[model samples]
Target chain A: MKRKYFQRKFDIRTYECDFKGQLHPLALFNFMQELASTHADRLGFSVQKLMQQKMTWVLSRLHLKINKPLRWGETLTGRTWPSGRVGKYALRDFQFFNQTGETTAVGTSSWMVIDLEKRQPLKLDQLFTSDVSLKKRALADDFPALPEIDNSENQCKFAVRFSDLDLNRHVNPVSYIAWALESLPEPVLFRHYPMEVEVSYRKEVFLGDQVICKLQQIQGTESLSYIHKLFLEKNGQEIARLRTLWK
Target chain B: MKRKYFQRKFDIRTYECDFKGQLHPLALFNFMQELASTHADRLGFSVQKLMQQKMTWVLSRLHLKINKPLRWGETLTGRTWPSGRVGKYALRDFQFFNQTGETTAVGTSSWMVIDLEKRQPLKLDQLFTSDVSLKKRALADDFPALPEIDNSENQCKFAVRFSDLDLNRHVNPVSYIAWALESLPEPVLFRHYPMEVEVSYRKEVFLGDQVICKLQQIQGTESLSYIHKLFLEKNGQEIARLRTLWK
Candidate 1:
């Protein structure tokens, strides 16, 4: 039987830490992204091959809950597998484990196969068939609905640059996460860290484009949850929305 | 006899690329940094151990020349070793090799032992000593002097964020390189990629400090070289200087 999951072990680098002395969200998301890419490639759905067909995987949603922030020099393993599909979107899940084989973090993501020529999502048959045999979900959770953020307390503009792009020439998901995290107030940033996040993508950000990020509290002061909304500074069209559960 | 050099093998990640389908300078510097730290740990002078003694290795300068930019999925190895001591600074060198052992790039850096509480420089004695059994320099290179960036055409301010810091809580070298790259205009960024860089650190940047990056072309229209000078936006105190050779 073909294995339903793939594991990649890595040692957290010193540069991957943040001001609070733990793993940066960028690093965590990057590892999960890397694992997904590698697993897809090994299963004959590599990004390069898909690009030849003018198709690419676009992350549509992500829900992650970090149990513990990894420390520098610590060894951790990321295991990811396909968690079935929902219509045109391909679902995947990830688990982070320490050297002792205990899970330390978990994440789930939804992706759409976008065709370059049509500028739309392609069907699962058009791309490549996923391993239907594997039916595992890392989280026993559902997609959280986005809370309306009526008024934003703070907003910042970002002009995408060369460093913001990837081999796909698109701004990767981790960049958006970094931008959202950076937009938060220093007090909020230092006071608490995000234990869970639900992100939804509505549009693509290209190089040289100016985008604005607005941050505000989603619910009341009862539970710490903030909503981050991103839009094009030119047209103010909503591009992405994210809600964070701060611990 | 003690081993004098350490080599780590890895492939470039998708998040590490820029506009072109090649590796970003920040990613290259990061891998080199990881190798050096790992080597130090194996030699019994790891950061954690040094921190117990209230001492840490601070990167003072780094000079790197890239013959080619690595592509995603290309396997590469980073080999680094101590070259000797340069007064209060410890000298080290690095080389990036392809899977076939062909050298793709090279770099050199100097580090200073700093007393954390005292906020002062310390001699190499305080930190555990390196093995003197081997004395081999990776390249016949010397530190480059700071270029004269008298009047800069482009200037941008970067407020040190939680993501910009490292385990040492100071802004890392790669963050400075990223800031300099981001400060360039789109035309200049897409037109030229850096082939060589020599960086010098004068002062430390802390959290919430807005550091100004001033960029200008050095020399004439002959060989492309640019100078990036960083300082506090408010106090105008010099922080770091970087000279880049463009291809």
Candidate 2:
């Protein structure tokens, strides 16, 4: 029997909306941070306490899906649990609920514990001796698949802007999503919601450089999937390739 | 001599940071949106066009700031200019710059040609005008005086979680500046700074808020001339208040 880990709840604020008055995709990422931090706190590990121990949690990969739009002023609850441990990695699952107890969105994230001094990955087993019991739930099997990179025709370009960066002084992964999505028209982009997303960063983007974002769409009968590529450009020199999957 | 309407230059991404690696201040605001949009198009009459039609912009006002920080990826420039004319409301000032001269934030705002909308004590003439060749410069002032509120200590209780409600489904206005200056210990709250700020709302904020921020001391004495506030909360509240002056 799998042990059940503690669940945490968080409220929604108005400051998380876009021009359309709905929560922006990037804002959802921040909510995930809060949910995860709260869960850690209940489990004898908090971000603040970890920092005191010179340790941090770095997000290696994230796959998310938004089934419904969250509106402003609506009180929403976010619940999270750790699924399992794999070598040096930990898989966590999240579910967002509305005031009515209906699920609005679901997310799964892969994280690595790191030693603050060495910045090296640490194993989950080394951190916790017993399994943090979370309600036994099946892992999401509907995550979007990774995109295939074809060095041909699908070309997208973007300039790395200061706003695209984050506290790590590195280009925020979300900015890549914005760039990739912005390539589409406003009407189409706004009308069709993001049901699933998968992104992989090939290299880091730096300051004062122009970036190129490329995309290719794979059409399906009922849904569609896209592959995105991001590159740093200076006089046509390629810097990096970022591949993303969106449906 | 050329007249200056508004003068402020800041690195693009630097404007968006806190202690953590999240987008520090809320990104969607009417003022910031207008600045971004106008900056992208570079059209002198966009604001005028909107006003001439007697259609004004109204936002729900959602401002939130976070303790998570933003990193540096590329060079960003933020600029504000005047979008000329709307009947008695002549000079509409806007600020927006891009990561690489491309607008990332943009919007269209409404200024009352007549104060009839709010039924407040002020009138249109007391606000603005369109004598383009006049010697009056809008940018002359570095910081506008804080609007004198009824400053009752009883009315000024330290904002707690419940009071942090997003009445408009967005973060409350009172909390905007508070979060931006969170990094400063209580000793710095009362200190004065030479800073200029203008925040126009696009949405609202709601409960269970957590804000974290810091102070960026510019040139001059460190005796209190620089202050900032960021509402970096999880539930939905995020706002930013920035102040800078010669110490």
Candidate 3:
């Protein structure tokens, strides 16, 4: 029988933690991505395996909700499983829990297989037919589409460095999340912690590329929210959009 | 008998690897930092313990020699131990090996204890005495001082992002190395791999700080060398210096 889920244990390293000694959100995303890749590998669809067929998985969207902070030196158990397909997108869900077994975060991601040479998305049905639980999901709610920011109060520009590239030779998706958060106000960044984050990746970025990040804040009754948009500076192409809720 | 050394095991995550699927030097530094911190913690000199005493350990200088490239999904065993005091500086040594027991890297680092309130360095003798291997050294050669780069051929500027800060609320030391390498030529970065690196931390950088990295290349008969200097863009204060040998 094939395993329906995969779980891995992680010990939070000191460098992976923030000023509060808690695991940074980027580290959490790395953990989730690792777990998901391992699960996919077990099902014979890893990046290495896919590369043999001139195809690779691209993370198009992800939504993560942090319920509790994972602290340094703490052990985190991350679990992920396939949640079947949604049109041309392959869906995966993740859950993170501390050693005490309390849920720390839940995340859902959408992926698409792309032809490496052609740079075009491939239909999920033609490539994968893994046994997925169509009804199981770490997050039950569907993510609302994040709108592009037009009138932005804060902006930051970044030149993609060599360190930003991963195995795909493109800027790692987590850097986009970091750039989005970097454009927020100092008060919002220092005074509040992000509780929920939704990201939609529209284009790929490469080394030596320049990008601009724009952010707009929205004050809510209970918490503060921000809309972030990242664009390629060369052609004004929107590379990614993000929505973050903080408390 | 007092324990003289500490060891830890790690599995390289996918995100930690580069385009060639080999572990990045930055990730290696993170692992080394984590292992060193854990050793200090085990010996009752961790960051938490020092912070409670209104003091903290500051890394002053480090020299690393890489013998082999660690790849994704491989198991790495890291070992570190105190090498006693060198004047006002306390020294530590590190060695990393793969599962097959081949040495992958060796490093030596100097650290100083600083009074947090006054931002003053304290004498090593003032700290509690701990038994260390004074004769054992990971790398026998003492690091030569890196000179400032006057006529730099390449330059890059970066604003300290929120993600760059660690528990000390200062830009983590690894970012300094990354910034130094970011100024190198693209061919040197992609065609060759760094074999040896030496860094000296002259000052601390905080959020909202803008820093400029300058690099000068030296062509040698056997290999290529780079001299890097990082300065505060606001005041031109030199923050760090580095020398990297690549093959």
TM, every model: 0.92, 0.53, 0.97
- Best by the TM-score measure: 3
Best by lDDT: 3
Q: Which ranges of candidate 3 are over 4 A from the true structure?
A: none
Docking class of 2: incorrect
Task: Estimate, for each residue in B123-217, the C-alpha lDDT of model 3 and write its tens digit.
Answer: 87768664565568998756568866668888889889898888888999899988987788898889988888899999999998999998888
DockQ for each candidate? 0.64, 0.08, 0.84
Chain A TM-scores for all candidates read 0.94, 0.75, 0.95
i-RMS, every candidate? Answer: 2.1, 12.5, 1.0
Better of 2 and 3 by TM-score: 3
TM-score of 3: 0.97
Q: What lDDT does each candidate get?
A: 0.82, 0.48, 0.87
User: Which docking class does model 1 fall in?
Assistant: medium
Model 2, position A52, has a per-residue lDDT of: 79
